[model samples]
Target chain A: MKRAFIPLLILGALAVVSAWLALSFGSVNTPWQTVWQVISGNERGLPFDLVLQLRLPRAINAFTTGALLALAGALMQVLLRNPLADPYVLGISGGAAVAALCALLLGIGGLWLNAAAFAGALISMLIVFGLARGAGAWSASRLLLTGVIVASGWGAVIGFLLTVSPDAQLRGMLFWLMGDLGSATQYGVGVVTLVLGLGLSLPLARNLNVMARGELTARALGVPVARLRLGLYVLASLLTAVAVMTAGSIGFIGLVAPHVLRLAVGNDHRILLPGAALFGGSLLLLADTVARTALAPQQLPVGVVTALLGVPVFLYLLSRAERR
Target chain B: MSVQIPIIETRDLNLSIADKAICRNLNLRVNPTERWGLLGVNGVGKTSLLLALAGLKIPQAGSVHLQGRALSELSGRQIAQICGVMFQDSDDAFPVSVLETALIGRHPYLHAWAWESAADEAIARAALQAVNLSDCAHRMTNSLSGGERRRLALAALLAQDPTLMLLDEPVNHLDLHHQIDVLELLTQQVAQHGKAAVMVLHDVNLAMRYCDHVMMLFGYGEVLQGPVQEVLTLDNLSRLYGHPVRSVETPEGCLFYPGKT
Candidate 1:
């Protein structure tokens, strides 16, 4: 407990550096000192406009989205007690994607699209929760199976929508399906959701640690297992909803961030949750930065960048952990 | 002398699974400083009975009381303050340290946001010492062998320090020496601290040597409960398992084994 903070502090520094990089580099690069001057209110014009107005909000949204997804992933893993569990594995992103695509098909854009996606995510969450509970005892595997099947159903709907849509809408729908952050101009909802999630979950860190062992063991150790599980499902689903609304269906970070951190820092959630948030936020910011700049004006989806960067790192960590 | 209140009591408890009956209208009282052993054949619901007693399972009929309060009336946290349970198997699906696992004993006593204190750490350390895992505190649970993991489970239960302990197959993976050592440790704790324990065990002789009282479950909801000397006999042992039993008196006590193949 005493030394847990050192890793978090380093992750914090990494987050700061990633944010700075996001501010400085893009299709048109801004040098570090000029970017600093623009941010510090000492300069005006294109640099200031680009730094503060354009890139700043997008960068904040990227960090918030990544943090939300990663923390949600960590909680989801604990809630399911499965190492493979991720924020999107339960169909939250698929639901959001189906709704967002439907909204786009109706020519809806901006805030209404986000609202439709959020409503879709919540509805999917409730459906999975109700069906997984069923008539028998509630078990993690039951929930996982229910979520996976529901996600597939939503995938079919998304495919149908994409097939019937016009050529003009097809490209946009594909970008959203692949997860794009270019349209994100507001950070308020995502930031607040991430903060509230971390605040509420940190207090339950010890309970989550016990929960990761098994439901029966958790119940034996005095945790109100049913109630805690309900809370986790709701929290993780909402975090994923906010992330999907902020970006589209950003992957890899949700599945890989917590896992990589668990290998690096062990599985004490007190450190793992906050550490996941920081590391995940940083990783996504850097990924997005590379996404917009690497192709130089023909931006690859941020989700593509995340998977391209995350897979190798995650496999390396898993192999190293097994060796120990 | 003051009258003693049983640490745990069950009134007219009926337990069953599907169509199979475990026990019927069973009344039981376990006092402090007593160690009770539950003996039965396979599929007789010894583990289920232990769960029912620990409030982890609801009895099909009747009620279970902890220190006079109905088990249903108390919160899980409140029940945990008075009782701790040790399950038969240990599953470490994720990585956790030995000391960290033992500190889980203090979980029921902690506030939601609080970390385990120095005092809690000391208690965990003492518990590991009692289980002979003191030097392995920092080791991950996945690295521990079966016997070591079972001992670690026991250590966690000791750290819980509840008045009543309900253990299911507490000696499942242990060797002869460690089995006796763990049972003797439980005996000493019960005697010295006025705590109580109810165990589900397979070995009748170990049960005979350690428990002051015994409960035997025969098929079809029939049960026998009383002082060990009065209830654990050659006939009851034979009837309990549906096999003939033989016993030889020794300096330590009477030991029973199968009479014929």
Candidate 2:
């Protein structure tokens, strides 16, 4: 109990400090009080506008997207009972990426891209669920294999679409594929926040816990296993879709955050779910800060920065866990 | 403690896998106070029969009724509430504490959003005590020895407080003492609490000693089933194993020894 409490307290303190550092320490260094004042809507200067309009929304977007991705990843890992299973492992992100790419290449609007991505993700999850059931009732190996098959097929379709798209729209589609956080707006932030809040709450946490024990056990325990699994996949897909639509296919945050949190804490979904969300948010916010400040005048893509930082840390943890 | 209704009943049940018949035209009844031993050699479909009884496998033909309701029609949770099953080998994925795994037996009674109540916790604790695993409740399940895992599995079943228990090779890895301890516990539960238990035991001697009734499955669709002394004879044992065997009845119980004459 004491061991659990101390890490939680320390993580909580670190998150607060990170949030403050994210808001205050940019290329145009606004003072802590000024950042607070801007956040509170008491200031009306250009610095306030810079903080509120640009950096603040970007920070919040990164944090919320990270939280959503990590939550989805954690849920996916528990649901499949495989440490390697993440949001992308199920072809959910691939599906969303395909839809987003089509929207961008076809000259569709931004809002439509979000909807398209969400629909694609939902459809892909349904297909995966159906295929898994058809093959033989939610076997983890079957699900993983099915996901790989579907994801690869979808990736091929994405490649075909990209080849056929007009050259003028290619740049924007490429940026979306690479993942960017520069396009976050007030409305986008609000929408992602609402979705993230709903996704991270009680239902997902409780159901994820039940799912940690294999599906048959979950069913025997009165979990309505199929329904719960379907619901979780849909909810996770929705969260991933929103993140993908808003910030492109930000890869490693979703795959890495939950796993790191799991190593720090244990595999109890109640703790891992919330911990993943918070730690993911903090990590992404820090990554975004680096993306903006490292280049000064020009921003590196937040996705690139996160992947660069996440991979080594993730590999080290994997090796350490393997040794243990 | 004679119950009016049989806790489990099957009528002319048939099951097959890939056109290979496992069990056919099988009928059985289990009273709430009975302890039944299902004895069969390897590949005799003992596990399959137990799985069918536990509602984990669907029979191809005929019916299984649990307390007068069709087993197929009952929800998994409803079946679980009335029947607890211990599989031959369970894949323990997470490093859950022994107490946490045992507490999962309380799942049928728990609401989706609520934590396990104090009463539920107390019952789980009592189950651990019953299995002599109270001291190891906080230890990781993966850390337990094979015999300890079997005991923990029994504790999990006990925590469910079910009217019927289905055990598939429940004594597979247990030592002699622990095996006797588990059977004794089951006997006590049947006698005192009116719980019905159906177990698949490979050891005919253990089955005869502890089981009130025995169901023997021989190859080529032959079955010999009745009270232990009558059904477990030299002829039946020889026919089942496809080898010559001699059975001796000591003052304690019956034992079978394989030989050629």
Candidate 3:
């Protein structure tokens, strides 16, 4: 436990610094003292509302979304025994995106759009699980292959939806698909889930480590393999759904955060899950900061910045680490 | 006379897959201090039977009881308290340390949210030492050789410390010396602690040497089972395996060999 803390504390500290940067240094860069004064409610000006209302919520939302997606990805990787698996492995994001795109095309806004995205995510989860639990013995390959196929099928549907949508709404759909954190509100839901997931799943982290070895071995070691798998699937899917609801479909962080930790700490979920969450949160927060200030007044999508920052760094790390 | 209840028993157990009967009427009882060897050709349901006995799978018919209780009534964790299994192969998806792998055996003993105590860590370390893997406790499992992985599995089973140990092809991928060492360790555990075991072995000679009781399965649910001496005759062996077998008597008991067809 002590071994896990040093890295976690470091990531947490980095997260704090990133949040500070996001708050103080946006398009209209302000001093840290001004941001602090605004936070403490001692200052009244344009900087105050910008720091409190605009920057603070956006940064918190980005952090929570990144944390949830990365944690969900870590759990999914363990569950499926595939490092390539991300938060979107079971087609949840695909489902959510499809629903969100449809709503955008129909000019639906506000709470209804979030509701549709969640409903679609749930429907996708059911489709994959129901099909995977079909007749005969259960195998990891079967479940993973089923999910991949379902995801592909959802991709086809999403492509069709994109083609038929009117030109005016295309920008909204595309921006959402690319994941824009600028529009996110109600940061509380994602954070609550992130805490709940980390708290509840930490106890099961040991079990997740054993299960990744193999289902038969886990069962023989006395783990309720079926129940554990089901629980992980549901938890990871829920995290992904909520994340998509919060900030559209942010990519790369989910896949990259866990692998970076895997390189540092050898796949022991006890530390890896939380470590991934913190690291992922830091990454996205930093990316959001860069996105907001990189182009001055015109902000790039949070998802674009995450990939742009994540991919090259991840590749470098992968090249440095010995191939497993 | 004090009659001891069997540690593991199958009451008229029926084994099948996809509605086809693989074995039937398996009325067997395994007591403490006894070891049984399961012998069958490829695809003759040996692994399936091991899985069933370990309570990892449902019986097509009837029940498997552990210490006079139905296995279905017990949780997987509870069943694991009395029995531990070593598979022919370990999963290599994610890399874990040898010590960490061995400590998995202590899972049945720990609670859902409990971490393995220092005492548990000590036991796991002792198991690694026993397997001569103490030096490699920190080594990743994927980096180990086949023989090393086999020993790692035994070390885990040792850490489990269950009364009834179910080993499926425990000798798989082992060298000659490691094979003898593992069998000797198991035989010693059974002799000294009265531990019960059910093992599947492909080598008839090793089975004859190590196991006191043997079960030979003929295809389509026919079985020949009893005390090893009475059931392991050359004629019976030849017929059971559907190959000509020759048994030679030596100072080290009986050695069986396959005759040229």
Candidate 4:
């Protein structure tokens, strides 16, 4: 636990640096000195306003959104008892995308759209839980199969929604689907959700550790298996919904962060959960930085940057592990 | 010892799977200091009986009493504190260290939301040490060899330190040396701690060596339970297995194996 702290501290440093870089460079570039001046309250005007008001909050939002999504992913993997399970594995983003696109097609925008998306995500979660947990001795594979089928169903619905939408609205919906931090201006809700998610998840890490063994083992060990599972399901859903509500549907960080962290620090959830959170936040912020500056005038969605940056790094890590 | 309640008692019990009755009108008592070996052919519901005894499943009829209280009346945690179950197989999806896996045995004792204390760690360490897995405490469970994993599972159950143990094929997948090692450990547990255990065993010779009582499933929901000496007859064994099995009078007692057609 203590050894993991050093890497976590380094990741914390990287998170700070990513924030600084996010604020200092973008469409309208500002020097590091000016970013400092704005923070110290020694400077005012365009550079100061951009750093403090716009980029700073957005960067914080990016960090927490990634943190929440990664935490959700890590929790879902444990809940499903499958290493490949991700936040979106249970059709979360698919549900959200369908609702958000439907709202856009019907001329709904802003908070109403966000509300529909979150509602859809919750609905998908409940549906998967209900369908997968019926009657028989419920296996995690059964749960995963139900979620996968529901996700595929949601994917079809999302595709249909996309095909019918007018051309002019397509770009915005696509950006939403691919994930965008451009509209991630609210830091308060995201920050609170991240804190709450981690605060609650840390204590349950022990429960989750036993859970990772197997459901039967967990039950035999005296952990409240059903209640623990319910708590994890709700927690993972809320974290996913919050992340989606904050930044659309960022990908890769949720899937890759925990795996990488697990590969690095043994699978003790006490360390794995927090490691996922910090590393996830850093990875997303770094990706968002690249997203904002890679094309300069035309900003790419953070989701694209995440997949691009996360895949090669993950593949290399996988190869290295295989070699060992 | 004169005034004692059986660690586990099942009365008028019926068990089935998907409408096929496996056992019926079964009454059993496993007392502390008595090690029970359940002998039956595959699909005769040996594992099912064990699961029901462990409170993981409901009997089709009647009730199970743990330490004189109805199993249903006790909370899962209370049941777990009194009884530990070792499953036959597990398809683990995530990786955890061997020590962490063993620490799960301490779950019933720890307070809600509290981490394992130093004493719990010490106990877990001792359990692993007993299984000869102290060296693999930090190794990933998925990375351990088959015998090592099985022993680790046993170690976890040992760490639970339950009064009654329900083990399904506890000696499965063990090498010859480890098989004797594990059975000896289990016998020591019963003799030293007075913990009652019922195990589903495929090896009749092992049962002859270790068990104080025996239960043989006689198909069609019939069973006979009594002292090992009285219950472990070749005729009953052949009938239970639906094959010709014979026993030889060796120095170590009756050695049972499949006879000629």
Measured by TM-score, the strongest candidate is 1
Model 1 Cα lDDT, one tens digit per residue, A1-324: 675779899999999999999999987789999988997789998989898998999899999999999999999999888876899999999999999999999999999999999999999999998899887678888899999999999999998999999999999899998899999888999988999999999999989988876777788777999899999999999999999998999989998989888877888999999999998899999999999899888999999999888888878877887899
Query: Candidate 1: which pairs clash?
Result: none
* Winning model by DockQ: 1
lDDT of all predictions: 0.92, 0.78, 0.88, 0.86
- Candidate 2, residue B57: CA error in Å? 2.5
Q: What is the Cα-based TM-score of model 3?
A: 0.96
- lDDT order of candidates, top first: 1, 3, 4, 2
Q: Which digits, one per residue and each the tens of the lDDT, describe model 2 over residues B79-137?
A: 88988888776556666788877887887776555677788889999999998999998
**What DockQ results for candidate 3?**
0.72
Clash pairs, candidate 2, are: none
Model 2 regions lying over 4 Å from their true place: A1-15, A106-109, A119-123, A126-138, A157-171, A186-201, A204-207, B1-3, B219-223
Query: Model 1 over residues B163-238: C-alpha lDDT tens digits?
Result: 9989888999999999999999999999999999999999999999999999999979999999999999999998
lDDT of 4: 0.86
Q: Against the true two-chain complex, what DockQ does each candidate achieve?
A: 0.73, 0.41, 0.72, 0.57
Model 4 residue A202 lDDT score: 89
Question: Where is model 3 chain B poorest over a 10-residue stretch in terms of lDDT?
Answer: B16-25
Model 1 residue B82 distance off true place after TM-score fit, in angstroms: 1.1
Q: How well is each residue in A26-130 modelled by candidate 3, as lDDT tens digits?
A: 778889999889988899999988998888899999999999999999999988888868989778999999999988888998878888988889999999989
